[model samples]
Target chain A: MKYTEEHEWLRIDGDVVVVGITEHAAEQLGDVVFVELPEIEAVVAKGDEVCVIESVKAASDILAPVDGEIVEVNEALSDNPGLVNEDPQGDAWFFKMKLDDLRVLDDFMTEDEYKDFLG
Target chain B: MSEHSTELKQTPLHALHLELGAKMVPFAGYSMPVQYPMGVMAEHLHTRAHAGLFDVSHMGQVILTPKHDMAALEAGLEALMPVAVSGLAEGRQRYGMFTNAQGGILDDLMFANRGDHLFMVVNAACKAEDIAHMKAHLADVAQVQPVTDRALLALQGPQAETALAALVPDVRAMRFMDVLSVDTLFGALWISRSGYTGEDGFEISVPATTVVDFARLLLDRPEVAAIGLGARDSLRLEAGLCLYGHDIDTGTSPVQAGLVWGIQKSRRTGGAREGGFPGADCILAELADGPAQLRVGLHPQTRAPMREGTEIWDASEGGQKIGCVTSGGFGPSLGAPIAMGYVDSGHASTGTPLWGEVRGKRLPVTVCDLPFRPSTYKR
Candidate 1:
């Protein structure tokens, strides 16, 4: 598992990168009520805001972890947005993308590094 | 009192909220629960259908008395507010606003005449500033004391009276805007027939020492469920009630905000037209003709809700930026997207064509009257 400073986590599943919010971020956001995801096939750059997550209190933007072409966007969030709050790491995957350069993962923190960063 | 930094203040019911798995957030410099595990939409719908118990201890409660003469205290309060304080009957409440010299509202507040004493409740965010402002102006004639340790709980819904009647029987007979002293399981409390949400409800003021016991007694009822600030905002929005700093501010007048009814009829017609209240001329004139910019309700053409700060344009005038949305959200009761904003009087009528620019796209909208959902307050 690789994590960004913005609290997004990405897991490489063969050629597709599964992305979702981290537990720490979801806890701070409180109850996740709505999620707006990018369209499939849309090209986004690293650090670009590509998604929005709204809780009861406020809304926050989720940034792209790497320059990539979107392969799959999570449609379940439109109906069951609470999945993000219930399971931020597992069933709440936001989108999958094909990385333009696989080396971008080098800049992300590992699970151990993220635990220390949170402390 | 507990190291007044930027940290959110916790009420006595904080532990109870957390135990209910409420989603907590910072509001008015306090760590408050915005919703419980049920979520905002569900909580809002439930409150309208049943009863919702809300923790409103964050609001500032204060007592005012005469330092010199009793008449002087009433005159001082009346000078600062638009309400006719002198005419208010004992055990009655009145809604009023503090205005600036330009006729803009500084803060909307509730004042109650408690026999020889006056009681008030101000918004959480504006409490400190309001107290300071009142002290600076009325210190010579009146004494202002802040009751920061008190706890305020609101039981709101159609069945609130029924649930509360079991504890305080007379609470059910209290008329709207009336305050009554009732005895409860915990102790004596001041129960007022008023609430922020446009529903039949009561706000109970209890001592800080026994607030927890009082809360637990109400929670024991199966008809009551704990609600948070999230549902509170959505409920009030559906009722077309204004939230300070969003719907009205130090720059918006009562007339523009559709609160002209709060201005007493005697004050409008009597010799008090040129009275020494702040911005009397501007407010009285606006009352006579109408404000240049009027607050109106909006119904978006699509399901996408238009949020605050979304620019509004007139399609007939080259899409000119005429005004901006102040408060907007989905009204579960109305089953549509509703909003309120300031617009030019020419384009403020119902059915006026308007557009809300969101995400570089113009969403078709129409100007409508307020309270998109009819109010069910037991008036």
Candidate 2:
């Protein structure tokens, strides 16, 4: 798993990858009451808003860290959006996508590097 | 009260908020906690189910005592507010507002008749100005004293009475809008059976020096959790209560804002104090003829929350903007997006469908009965 400056984490599973907001992002967002994800088979460019996270306080846009084609979305979140806060990096992932450019992964930060950057 | 907000002021519970891991935000010139570790949703639900203690010390408190007689003091206050203050019984409180000459709201406040004097609490953002306005207007009739020595706390929820009863027994006997002076372990406490969350609750006004320790004593109970301003806003919004600057402002009149209920019968037409307060001509006229626009509950059909300043358009009138959303957010209690906005009187019906423009996208919304959640006040 790697993190981006936009507070999104990418979990690589061979050629397919899963994406979700980071724990720090979830904590900052309070409790997410709604999640708006891009439709499956949608192609998103780097820095494009692929998802929106809404809270009672405010709404935030979650952008794609790299260009990719979305394959699946976590359907469970639509009914129980609080799952993002409970386990943002695991089962509560936003969407899965096949990486269009492998070079974008090199730009992400490692777990230790992201921890240091957050501090 | 300083114009320069570069350095934020801290409340009496600032250190405790930091200890509780609260997310601090700048609000009304103070660095106050917006939410705690429980997050807004859990905190709001907990407040509805159990007790939630809130540090409301940032709100302004003022004590107005008569220099002559009680009636004179009441009349003095009546000159500034639209509510019937002279008739308010002892240990009773009524919601009122400071109206401008054009029938606009300067600020809405809660004024309690304390037998010997009056206790008024105004919004924090406009407190300084409110104090100034009152002092300048009533300097001859009463002594306007701003309460600087007290810290206020709101213990609100279904179990608030049970939690507060452990500290003060008199609280159990009080009903909604009832006020009392009771003694507790820390010091003398003035309690009011009132809160913004539409729950059965109490507002405790205690000495500033001992407030932190006193609040900590209450937090020791399992039924109580410290809630922040974030949940406070949502809870009140769910109850259809207006936020000072957002829902009601200087440009909005009490009648247009759905606050005509606050003005007593005696203050209305054919009553003793009819047409006496500021902007009474316009207010009374609007009361009789109905306001051109009305503040109404807006339910956006979609789950996406429409925020403040979102424009509302007439669905059948070729997208004509009839009003704007003043307060909108996802309601934890309702499990959907709820909002309150001022709309054209023709479009303010309970079932009238409208359109809310959010980020340039039109979202379906309907006018519904206020208080998306029914009030559970222990009246």
Candidate 3:
């Protein structure tokens, strides 16, 4: 598992990278009320904003961690946005991306390093 | 986390907010709690179900006493706002606004007739100017004294009576809009049976020194929970209440904001005390002729919140801009997105269909009657 500075966590599953926000980000956002997911098969850059998350307090954006194509998204979030706050790193995974080369993930922080980065 | 963190004012309950793991944010030049550990959603729902305590110490509290007699002070107040200050029966409070000569609202406020004197509560952001405005206009007839040693707390919800009456039994006898001072073990509590939330509640003004203890006593009840600014806003919005600086502002007139109810019949045309206040000509004319724009409730057809500043367009495919949203967000109690904004009078009907542009997409919105949910005031 890897984490980005933008408070997103990525996990490799076969040839896809499952991406979701970190627990820290979810806690900061308070309660999630609405989520606008990106379209499946949409090509995105490393820094592209692909998702919009609205909480009871304010709205936030989820940036694509690395360059890839959005292959799948968590449709469950549309009906139950609270899942993002309930399980941010697991069932709350936003989408899966098909990266051309998975080695690019090596540059991201590991779980231990992400904790230090959060500090 | 603003750059002027050191300059922000702290309420008497600041330390207690921190102890409860509240997320403090800068609001109206004060370091206040935006939410507690329960979060905004839970806090909002909790207030609807039971009772929620809010520390509104940042709002301005002023006492206006007549140097000569109460009648003279009533006239002094009548000259500043459109409300009927003279006929405001003792122990009753009324909503009012300071208006500019052009008929625009300077600030919305609540003033109660406490028999011997008037107790006025103004918004925090406009406190300094509101105080100065009152002194400049009514100094010779009334003594405008700002009360800085008191903290205002709002106990709102269906169970508010159950929670507060347990401590101050006198409050149970008070009806909506009733104002009285009661003595308790804590101190002399100046309380009013009213609040911004559309709920049966009380707004208590307690001495700043003993506010923390009083807040803790209320929170210790099983029916009470500490709410924050975040939920306070959502609750008020759901109740169809206008927030100062939003929904209504210095550029909006009382008539355009649909606040004509605040103006007593005596102040209108052909009344006994007609045309004595500021902007009386424009306000009265608008009241009779009807305003060009009307503030109405907006119900977004989707789950996404259409926040403030979202433009409202006619329902046509390529329609002209008619208005802009002033207060918009998710309605926790209703489980959908609700908003209030100004629109052309032609499209202000309760069932009229409109369109609100959000983030580059035009979403369907309907002009619904205010207070998406029915207010449960103890009338």
User: Best-fitting candidate, measured by lDDT?
Assistant: 3
The sequence of per-residue lDDT tens digits that candidate 3 reaches over residues A1-119 is 99999999999999999999999999999889899999999999989989999998888999999999999999999999999999998999999999999999999999999999988
If ranked by lDDT, best first, what sequence of candidates would result?
3, 2, 1
TM-score of 2: 0.96
Tell me the docking grade of candidate 1. acceptable
Two-chain DockQ for model 3: 0.88
Candidate 3: where is the Cα deviation over 4 Å?
B1-6
The per-model lDDT (C-alpha) reads 0.85, 0.90, 0.93
Please give the lDDT score at residue A96 for candidate 1. 98
Residue-level lDDT of model 3, residues B1-379, one tens digit each, is 1344459899999999999999999898999999999989889999999999999999999999999999999998889899888988999998999998989888999999998999999999889889999999998889999999999999999999999999898899899999989887878999999999898899999999899999999999998999999999999999999998888887888999999999888999988998788899899999999999999999998888989999999964688899989999888999898999999999999988989998788999999998888999898
Q: Write the per-residue lDDT of candidate 1 for residues A1-119, one digit (tens) a residue.
A: 99888999999999889999999998787666668789899999987889888665566889988889999988988677778988999999999999866777978899999999999
RMSD values, in order shown? 3.5, 1.7, 1.5
Candidate that scores best on DockQ: 3
The docking category that best describes candidate 3 is high
Clashing pairs in 2: none
Better of 1 and 2 by DockQ: 2
lDDT at B170, model 2: 82
Candidate 2: DockQ? Answer: 0.80
For model 2, state the Cα shift of residue B40 in Å. Answer: 0.9
Q: Is candidate 1 or candidate 3 better by lDDT?
A: 3
Fnat, 2 decimals, each candidate: 0.17, 0.89, 0.83
Per-residue alpha-carbon lDDT of model 2 for A1-119, expressed as tens digits?
A: 88998888998887888899898999888888888878999998988988888887898998888888999999998888889989999889999889866667878999998999899
